[model samples]
Target: MGEPSAPGTPRGDRLHHPQLTTLVDTARFHAAHSPQVTAVVCEDRALTYARLHRESNRVAHAIRATGAAPGARVAYLGKESEHYYEILFGCAKSETVLVPINWRLTAPEVSHILQDSGSDLLFLEDEFGPVLDRLPTAPPKTVVRLAEGTGPAAWTAGHPDTDPALSPTPDTPVAQLYTSGTTGLPKGVVLAHRSFFAVRDALAGAGLDWIDWRAGDIALVGIPGFHVGGLWWATQNFNAGVTVASMRAFAPREAIDLIRDKGVTTACVVPAMLRMMLGEPGVEPDDFTTLRKIVYGGSPISEALLEESLALFGSEFAQIYGLTETGNTAVCLPPADHIPGHPRMKAAGHPYPGIGSKVIDGEGKELPTGAVGEICLATPAHMVEYWALPGKTAETLVDGWIHTGDAGYVDDDGYVFIQDRIKDAILVAGENVYPAEIENALERHPGVAEAVIVGAPDERWGEKVHAFVVPVAGREPSPRDLHRFLVDRLAAFKLPAAYEFIAHVPRNPSGKILRRALRDRFWNDADRKVN
Candidate 1:
């Protein structure tokens, strides 16, 4: 990692606080100001700020009854719901770290996280009970359902509405988000309340209005809450005391309906979701009249699709750039830069206020302007560390700077441009999917001897997973055969889009796979570029 670059335009602004403010205090603050305002809304439930604050206290008291110590892990396995936020705030009040698992992961993958976190208690959706049964080792923690009248709900009802008033410091961790490990195992990226809250305070304190949180925004949350991007977006809205219209998952038609019916004014979506919405039935430019801004990230957007969306939604488009380790987004392409034919359209915009970044060469020296190098950024939003992986943490977070494993360059104007991913992790439809994980799953098949996974350029999703397979001695594996084998073993998004049969998988002399060589075959066009 490189040393911090001089604070540029946005960085000149100073942080306002001497210490991090607890998220529990944030809830209390909102309740005091907007007691009757809608805070969280799901299918048929809308929780007011006062109710949300009181209920979270009850949840915290109930969780305390479970014998969970401070900083103990409390895991949730399910889709987005009011219950999710309840559990989130409840954990915050109890000083417990919340671990939101990716429900799309296979049973083994889920079990690995559960085992690693050693979570004291798990409050999961009833639908996920079968998945838990598929775990190789029975999880030893207490499991409760996240439903009304369940054991957990009954316990919460028995607790007082008064606050526990547990004192938690700014350094206290809030969540542990697991990133798909490039080496075939997932590693937890631990974030504190300061990781998200402090950054927002600093930006607003500096008069950064690109993400100005305003009341009556009516935000639509279509991103999966398991990822840091989704979680931070939702929290940003709540921090501003805005009404949040939550979605269980992103469905094109459902999003359109929410914008039209719920009068949603803003949303945090991915490029693929924008593409999917264009094809949804009955969608027209006027359908999104209520929407003012659409902030998208996780994958790059094609110029053609951006043009279509610009005309259709008639809403300002902003691009965000960051990773799990940086608390979702450290840089943003403001609405002013979204102009047609603008040069900064491809730029990731300047570093957020108070964010420090540098483009550095392999020697750890800052590169000259326009020189492609690894992007290193430091900010209040940066995660504290990789959970329990001190060695990996030391390698990634060097001297308080997070070495983003992305190759990029900074222009003289201070705009950053992302060129490629240095790490072999593939982003599929905004979700990080590593090739090694897919290859490991493929090798388990009897008909497959060896496999190499690569990302191919895709119009909808920024990249699609492509597999090159070499069959075992006498078995020739067809695409259908391999697809059938992986259907239940992996998430649908991680399934290979195309398969090529070869005699052997390519590797270097040292027995390491030359993934770039294999990946280059599908990305030969000069026109192919990602933000």
Candidate 2:
């Protein structure tokens, strides 16, 4: 056993400590150092570090009393709230892995996750009561309904609160995050204690100071806790002794109001969410005065949007790039890179200090600078393995590097410029076209609001580029007009062969455009996989 260190202290000059493998240590550290500080604030309720620790302890005890084994997986189906954090830490302390179900998933999808993970117990909010009742499983292992009061109300009344003395093994699994799986059904991404701690340490070493993490500083957590971004960001701030203000759903007006009224200094959002915030009619340049940092990611930002945000928020912006499999962030474009004149501003800054990343070809050969290829990553934060999918896991995690199917090139200065996902690349008339590049060009057009480029089947060409566009409010641009506009901006071959105007582009809960969904609609009758 190792002595408990300060919350933000780097362990042994390494990004992750080899011994501090349990997430419970984060709660313990805060309980010892800042017991009285408010650790979570949701709706009208609040939990100090001490209160949170005690609550998590009670939950852990209850979980164990339910016959959950040390390595058994427990699923949490709820929105962002203090209870969510409590259950997360409780699972950690009890040596159980938590599988947080995305609230946006349908009943069938949720059932699939539950059956796939073989979850022994489920902690669900009252909102999901009907969904739980509809599960086709028999006797349903155990279900706990979360409410404002203490003892189980409405569900599992006889459950007892077990003691908080359960000790976790260092290598125990802590969390199992389900990947969005654009190509197939979602697979559970297993994350061990070591993997999570590695990410926490790496984030701390990123050199970006979080204002809301200071004593009495307010942090607004609007992102869904089901995603890695929300879960880890809230956990990190809690460990640092900050007051977390959470919301069940993200409404731009409500989020802005929370920041303004509650003195929120830090927040995380994806590009689409930020765009919505910027679109709010009442928003002003000074509306975010208390905001010290706005961590944005999930997709690249347009240069125009970046400039506009910089003009409004000053220099308090940071861009992070990574997936759930890599534990939230493996690359960070820090605040300094927000400088418009900085050469790396357009690039995804350098790889995080301790994270190993490279641009490689299909044969695993390292590509030189300025060469576009697969972006592979190696880090302690890499996921343990995909649950029940050894073959898929072996393919993705080869020789320790998690091959991120994203295509990108590294510049001479070591800045990474991601072109697009390899699987998302469209072949139009035998010409390779990256949707991101075409979308970027289309977004530059004044009349376009949102655009998604997908490959549609064609007899002449293997696949043709089909663009689904959402035009600006009250301004509809003709397909021919847009085609003419793109002719000069992009290669003629990259222009969309057909165009369809839609009210809105379909996106996943995390705001990633559901390109696969769009492609599926067009290829429903096709025999091929890549349409």
Candidate 3:
């Protein structure tokens, strides 16, 4: 008989195999090909590919010395930094899973993750001392603070000229990225080495071919490192032998200046960050000339902002759509979509090669084109499983397909248009009103700066469509005017029953509207969690 495939070996197709075990190989590959090339750039430090490889190895050895078993979870709680990537790569080298905690999370939320993951060690940035203090119990293992004087100096030292032994298997768990959990407590999504690398290949296939990601390209990573955008993008650049400019904090002006001063070629941001950058005082055209590609997602962008951005930055914008469970983006709206008259420009473009996507009904049967339903995908980048949440994992993943819970419709031309969360659908007087459609219409109004629509309870109708709006600077359009603006564009039933003006809308770090927070104000005393 033929030899049985080893545990974690690729089955049938090597291209679709998992990557939990090959972290060391990836790190070593960059080290050999781009040793002297800058791999990471932080506020006060720079690391070449050789340096990142060596330092990651030292950190891996340190983790192993702590008696952490292979596959043990190691948590990193901090803002974005070179140390974050170092620890991530380090944990992967030692066959340990790295879990990055969202810096925006509250103490209670952070406590939940640390306890749930049963992390063997917690590496924290100094700024999070207060959050760490709120933990009910110390993490199960060591707590190493990333500061000037804490722990061994070698742990934080940058390696400029040393090579450490590489040890990683393809199936080893590299990371466990937690979902944002807008509806409930977050779940950790376990990603193998292969799944992580697949994202890089997917990016390349999605029109990032112009990236020139050899040892010369400088990648600026400004998003939160805990989030998939920061973590995955940084790793992709590193693997491609590109330098990474890591920002510890996100300030729009500083970020813009960094792009100009550092010769940064690539960047990733959400729509809100782009809005902020455009609104920043003294912001001039070509301020981002050094940027080659501006990858954006986590929320939709209006056509108005899209046109303004195209005028401001030229043709360098690409939209990506995915979640933590999918490692990163499974589908990309390529730069070509920015071209005028492109049919899919208004939609989320096609799925990446090697990724299968479909819109499905409640029965899991595929829905035909132009039908709105849950968007499901089968991809090599899907997470292995959710940590400590078997039932939840089972519910989300089935037969290699990950149910996205996001409501979207595929057009006859194969373009996908996301509507709203299935859970957030507004049922008003027996009519279905998606908040995104309303919000998009409201945003099209010249006086409306930003808008969020939610379903508020009503006696006559099951629920009422309520809109919270932020007006543009020096532009005050009353509720009636705004209503008149949308009257012709939307169905009469979809109009907002009430309007409230707010200075700003609540959002997560990723720029996603916190609808649950908005809904909580009205439904705090309700029986169920959501309406």
Among the numbered candidates, top TM-score falls to 1
Compose the digit string of candidate 2's lDDT tens values, residues 1-531: 011111122333312232345668778867877788888877667788887887777777777777888889999887887878878888888888899987666565578789989997988777878777766664247877775433232342344433376667546778998864544356898987766566555555553342224545677776678777777677667655678888877888888888887778888877656767788887986778888788876655656677877776653777777777777777767666676656666675556657777889989899987888988877777888899999988988988888878788777655667755566756442234567767877888889999988887664344678899999987789998898888755546567999999999998899887888888777777433342
- Each prediction's total of clashing residue pairs, residues at least 3 apart in sequence or on different chains, is 0, 1, 11
As a TM-score, model 3 comes out at: 0.74
By TM-score, the better pick of 1 and 3 is 1
Error of 1 at 157 (Å): 1.8
| Residue-wise C-alpha lDDT for candidate 3, range 426-486, written one tens digit per residue | 6553334568777877998999999998887664344689999999989979999998988
TM-score of each: 0.94, 0.75, 0.74
Model 2 alpha-carbon drift over 4 Å, by segment:
1-21, 136-139, 147-163, 203-213, 341-343, 425-531
Ordered from best to worst lDDT, the candidate numbers read 1, 2, 3
lDDT of 1 by residue, 1-531 (tens): 222232223433322332337778768878887889999888767889998888889989988888998989988888887778888989999999999999998888888888888896888887788888898877747887765323245658879988889877767898999988888888999998877686577566666656655657899887889999899989888877788888888889988988998899999999999999999887898899999889899986777888999999998887888999998898888777777677777787677767877888888998888889898988778888888899999988988788998889888767788887788778888888888888999999999999999888877788899999999988887899999999877878889999999887778899887888988877777443342
lDDT of 3 at 207: 31
